[model samples]
Target: MSVVPGLVSITFRQLGVGEILALLRRTGLEAVEWGGDVHVPVGDVAAAKRTAAATADHGVRVAAYGSYYRAGDHAPADFDAVLRTAVALGAPRIRIWAGAAGSADLTTQQRAGVVGDVRRITELAAGEGVEIAVEHHPGTLTDTLDSALALYAEVGHPGLRPYWQPRLGLGPAEAVHEAGALLPGLVTVHVFSWTADGVRLALADGAPLWQPVLGTVAGASAEAGAERYALLEFVQDDDPEALVRDAVTLRSWLGGG
Candidate 1:
């Protein structure tokens, strides 16, 4: 039941790597998923190494490399760079998008392309001892539970897994069900709470939802003898200070306090 409290670096896009590391230390977070868009850009092995060293120096682990590599949209060559960065960053996993379009919007050929790309990248990542996870996000194939499951089935690779997050407007019960269904292959969770209308709220406000959600994660991780991260994503008003407050709630929920 090793569910570690961590942060998603993109949560503070305005902050530099050093600043984010300091915030993680100040907040007592154990790990971070560095975003490729900023903190550690794709193909920048030097930056990756530097950030990796700094993270280690600050006593924070690299939970995963949050890469924006769209599974089917880009050439396979592009993923080569992404993998290089993740390897240099010493990340255990690389987070990627299923595709740009929603499941319902994708054609059969489009879906197959995404699936093939996922398989290819999974194999490539496995060679380097790194796992690949698709973002459970809207506007992509993983937007729905059924689609996400089907995509994983078709890819059919143990190296590939799904990163779970409560979809916007999803009720706690439904979120629990989704999390449970994805438990077998769950890698990491993006933790946050938002209103049905998209208003971001404090992590404490979502305790009702997260409490049970994290419980399920703990049980599953224990059963599999694996550790998973509950990484805080965005905070209320995109405020850095909001992260400090949210981290308290997150740590309390994880029984860190």
Candidate 2:
């Protein structure tokens, strides 16, 4: 693997198709990941097709399709559909989640089920040169890094990877620390901007965190075998330019373009 500058794969959930394509070009970012529930539902093939086409036309690379797949929910067919669309669109990564959080009964079966489905998807995606990366998201299944990693460990599938997030309601230090530790399983890192105690003008303005974040990324890069993409998934009501700035500063801090 080359020393990639941590490409920013923005989520298309908050932004529309056209706007997203335009933003990727304007920002000069190549990789993109999808969050089906956040934008176009994964089950909707028509919309997924349109989305896949648009990304291709604009010269944006589809890093992954973030799908809402519950470990307990045996829906490999559903994932197959999404993967088909993604493969057509040229995505090389697929993001799946752990079982839904707060469920009354959390069993090993739930974990095993997701592992099996993910392994199957990984095999299918590998044929298309895609990777199935598990994400650590908040307010959902496997919100924390530890729990998500446990499933990943138990599953013991080389294909099941991780997409790390710093702000799953954890402190900056904790978030950054966990993110650094999970580098081997990491595919990308979500970027966020912040003010001292309030909102900044935009996502670009979230430079405060970059100084420390770069350290985490650098250390992780050394630990991990390759330089994986440090993806920026900034969703703020503020200016999108700030979002780009947030991304740029992060790359710059990490010695990127």
lDDT of each: 0.94, 0.62
**lDDT by residue (tens digit), candidate 2, 1-257:** 22233233334455666776787677666666766664456556677778788877887666677766655464557667777666655567777766565322456655566556656777777777777777676544456666766666766767777877655335667766776667666767666654545453354554545556556666667666666666665445545675566556655666657
Candidate 2 segments whose C-alpha is farther than 4 A from its true place: 1-15, 37-59, 102-105, 139-141, 194-209, 218-225
TM-score of 1: 0.98
Which parts of model 1 have CA positions greater than 4 angstroms off?
Answer: none
lDDT of 1: 0.94
**lDDT of each residue in 1-257, candidate 1, tens digit only:** 28999999998899999999999999999999999999999999999999999999999999999999999999889999999999999999999999889999989999999999999999999999999999999999999999999999999999998899988789889999999999788878999999888899999999889999999998888788889999999798879899999999999888898
Residue-level lDDT for 176 in candidate 2: 66
Error of 1 at 183 (Å): 1.1
